[model samples]
Every structure is written in C-alpha cells, then in structure tokens.
Target: MNTTTVITHQPVAPAPVVVKITERDWSTSLCGCFDDMASCMYGMACAPCFACKVSSKAGENCCAPCCVPGAMIAIRMKVRTRLHIRGSLCSDCIIDSCCGPCSACQLSREIDNSCNGHLM
Candidate 1:
C-alpha cells in the first residue's frame, strides 16, 4: 500500500496596483468676442478694438470682433474647471515667457503644459 499527500499552492503572479490621478478645480477669467451679436448693439462706436464691453442697459458684459487683421477677437470672461495636473507643473509658464498676448492666454498655456497637453 502507498500513501498519497495533497498540497495547495497560491497564484504565481501578484495583482497589479492601479494609480488614480486626482483632479483639482481651477478657474480663470478672460475678455474676448461673444461669438454672436448684431451690429445694431454698438453701432458706429463698435470699432472691435476693445471687445470687452459693459451692456449699458443690461449691465452685463459683452464681446465684439477684433480690429486687427488675422488677430482673433479677445474678450474677457471667467474659465472654471477641474484639471488633472497641478498648477506648478503646467506649461503655461513657458508659453507665457515665449508668446502670450494676455494674462488669460498665458494662464491657459501654463495649464495646458502642466496637463501634458491634456487641458481642455
């Protein structure tokens, strides 16, 4: 007669660890064109030089077209959202130094850079 023994073994491979990237809320304000507006609003005074304007009756902010050729209209507005990357790591700092027309564009560039071009 022969005796047999049974043994149990654990799995050879270990589970992989998943790292989740945290998102943080960030906000920025800029001034530019409103995208859609009738000419009757501003009339002759509407030079499109300063897109940012205050509605005389509504008391709200408004935007207009740009005066310079090839230069898009720039308006002032607030941009708020959650970013996947941290502020310090953003590339806006680099772009701001190189080519930035306004503080808002510079900040957006920095955010885009920090997010590795993933900023929306």
Candidate 2:
C-alpha cells in the first residue's frame, strides 16, 4: 500500500505601518534666540552668512539668500511649511524682516530640533 501526503502553505503580509504627525509650534520661539548661543552669535556676527548656513541646512541652495529676492522670508516659510509648524506668511515676513537673525536662529533650532526627534 502506498500513502500520499499533501502540504499547503499560506503567506501572510503585515499591514503597512502608518504614522501621522500633527502641526505644532516651533521648537524654539522666534525671540528665544538665546536658547542656542552658537547660532545666536553666528547670526549676530554675520547675518548673511547665518542665513546662508540656515538655507543650506534647510535643503535650499546655499546662495538662495544671496541671490534670490526676499530669500530670508522664503526660507523661513519653507522651514515652517516643511516642518508643519504653525505660522502664516505675513508673520514670516514680519519676523524675517524685523528679526532676520532671530528668524534664522529660530529656523536653525527648529531644524535641529526636528532632526533630533523633537518633531513628535
């Protein structure tokens, strides 16, 4: 007598993981420039250079601030939008215009914070 054996297999796929992050405030306030002394000093010492550095860190052309008109406000807006931080273009314009260095420092801190996992 001969016996036959049958084997069956089932493949299970895991559900795709989904993560959602809500909009929130900036890691550091605009006037909270002193929170990061290094960036604050850098921005104070050389505003343009600081803006360029921040632009680069923000994944924008390093020369954007130097070459583009209103690049400071644009960079600020970009950072705000990319990070989903709560703000408005009018606010960005006012901040970037009146507080250029502070804005740059704020953007730098925000980028650093987000990169360091403060994004949650």
Candidate 3:
C-alpha cells in the first residue's frame, strides 16, 4: 500500500489598515491644495478648510495627514454633492507604477478627497 501527505500554507500577516479622510481632511493635505485649484479653478479653496485645521493639529505639511507605512489605504466614496474621505482598515498597493503627474490612483484619490473632489 502507498500513502500521500499534504501541506497547507498560511498568510504571513493581516492586511494593513487604510486611512479615511473627510471633506475636512481633504483640505489639509498638500495634494488637496493642488486638486482644489484644478477642480474648482481656484473658486472653492475655502471648501476644505477644516481638513487644513486637522492637519495643522497633527503637524502635517500641507493638509494631508501622513499615513503610516504599510498601515493604511485611502478610499474615495461619493457623498451628496461633495465627496468624502474614508479610510479602510487594510492597505492595498493598487497603483505601484504609472509615473505620471500622479503615479497611483490611490494617491490621486487621496488628493481628491483632501481637495473635496474638486479636481478631475
């Protein structure tokens, strides 16, 4: 008689956390500033001022809060006439390479959220 053996594999670790931002947070990050100009043609700069405040409290440069390495992912969810920011509890490197004005869509999304979805 003959017998066979099998082995199973396991995940190395849990997924990283994703960072979420509100319309308020969007105004703080530097990316937001750029996006705001692009989206609104410099008309809605005051929209995301709250985010700038939170970023200031956190000692963040510009309006965006610095994300922990491999700890968070940014997501954009539509809310009413404006777009809001929401962080996920996991990280995803969806856009590792692109090499444009914004390399990754994730980064662009974060910037958009920071700018209150003003940029296209």
Cα lDDT tens digits, model 2, 48-100, are 99888888888888899989989989878887888889989999999888888
What TM-score should be assigned to candidate 2? 0.77
Give the higher-lDDT candidate: 1 or 2.
Answer: 2
Span of ten consecutive residues with least summed lDDT in model 3? 72-81
**What lDDT does the true structure give each of the candidates?**
0.33, 0.85, 0.34
- TM-score of every model versus the real structure: 0.23, 0.77, 0.19
Best by the TM-score measure: 2
**Model 3 local distance difference test score:** 0.34
lDDT of 1 by residue, 1-120 (tens): 999977788657977989987755333322221221232234324433223322111122333223332222121121222444234423444432343344334233334444443333
Model 2: weakest 10-residue lDDT segment is 111-120
Best by lDDT: 2
Please give the lDDT score at residue 73 for candidate 2.
94
| Model 3 regions more than 4 Å off | 1-67, 75-92, 96-120
Q: Please, what are the lDDT tens digits per residue for candidate 3 over residues 34-104? A: 54344333223432343333333223433342343321122122211134433322212332112112222
